[model samples]
Every structure is written in C-alpha cells, then in structure tokens.
Target: MEQERDFTELSMMSKTRWNDNELRYFQHALSQLLPYVNPEGLTILHEINKEMQNRD
Candidate 1:
C-alpha cells in the first residue's frame, strides 16, 4: 500500500508537470496499465483521480 501510494504521488507530480497533450497521454497509459494492477492499487488510483477532480 505504501509503495502504491508513493507511486501514485510520484505519478501525480509527473502528471501535474505535463502539458495538456502530455497529460492526456499519461492518463491513457495509466488507464491501459490499470487493469494489471491489484485492487488496492486501483483504489489508490481512484482516490487520486477523485482528488484531481476536486482540484479542478
């Protein structure tokens, strides 16, 4: 869980640094990769998505 959270935070930071097109590509890659992740990781990703949405 800790590793997953760390990864999510890192990914979020990277995403924030991206321009619109780069962010879209990042999100697309993340969506494709998510199916292979564990449930807990998925949950963390979902939470992160929610936070991002709230920020917007």
Candidate 2:
C-alpha cells in the first residue's frame, strides 16, 4: 500500500487557497480518517475544526 503523507504538512507547503467547499470536503474526509490518524494528524483535524468554528 502507498504511504499516506501528513495532511498538515501538505497544507502548510501548498500555495493553493481553499474554498469553503474544499475546506468542508477536507474536514469531512479527515474526520472519517481520524480513527486511523496519528496524534499530529488528529491535532491537525482539531485545528481545522477550530478554524471552521471561528468562521461560523
């Protein structure tokens, strides 16, 4: 199986800006994978959730 890259690092290194839908998609996807993610990935998911909450 292909190894999964760290989502947080990928986000930090990317220059592309995320739209609302894209962010929602990522949040949903990450939430579904939370159970399998490492501690850092979990932290990233929480950070994403917090940002989403602040936007609301």
Candidate 3:
C-alpha cells in the first residue's frame, strides 16, 4: 500500500473554511486513519474534533 502523507498540513488549515459536510467527511476519514496515523495525525484528529465541537 502507498504510504499516507503527513497530516500536519491539515492542522495548518483553517477548518472554519470547510463546510459542515466537509468537516464530517474529514472527521470520518481521520477516524479510519487513526489506526495507522502518527502522533501528528492524532493531533490533527483532535483539532478536527475541537472544530466540530465549536460548531455545535
């Protein structure tokens, strides 16, 4: 399988620019990636989760 790229870039982005659906999609994708992601990916996941929470 091809190696996944670093998720740290996602952290640099403004999640606010993403629509709710997009955020949800990323959230799901990140969840699936959780098992294989590195520490930075975990941070990206947390950032997405926080963004989602802020929306609610």
Model 2 Cα displacement at 10 (Å)?
A: 5.7
**RMSD, every candidate, angstroms:** 8.2, 6.8, 6.8
Q: Which portions of model 1 show Cα errors greater than 4 Å?
A: 1-29
Judging by TM-score, tell me the better candidate of 2 and 3: 3
Q: For every model shown, what is its TM-score relative to the native structure?
A: 0.46, 0.65, 0.70
Error of 2 at 4 (Å): 19
Across 29-55, the per-residue lDDT of candidate 2 in tens digits comes to 989988898997787677767767766
Give the distance in Å from residue 11's predicted Cα in candidate 2 to where it truly belongs: 1.3
Q: Flag the better candidate by TM-score, 1 or 2.
A: 2
Which 10 residues in a row give candidate 1 its minimum summed lDDT? 1-10
Model 3 ranges with Cα > 4 A deviation: 1-12
Cα lDDT tens digits, model 3, 22-50, are 67877899799889989977876787789
- lDDT to native, each model: 0.55, 0.67, 0.74
Show the colliding residue pairs in model 1: none
Clashes of each: 0, 0, 0
Candidate 1 per-residue lDDT over residues 27-53, each given as its tens digit: 565678896978966765565565566
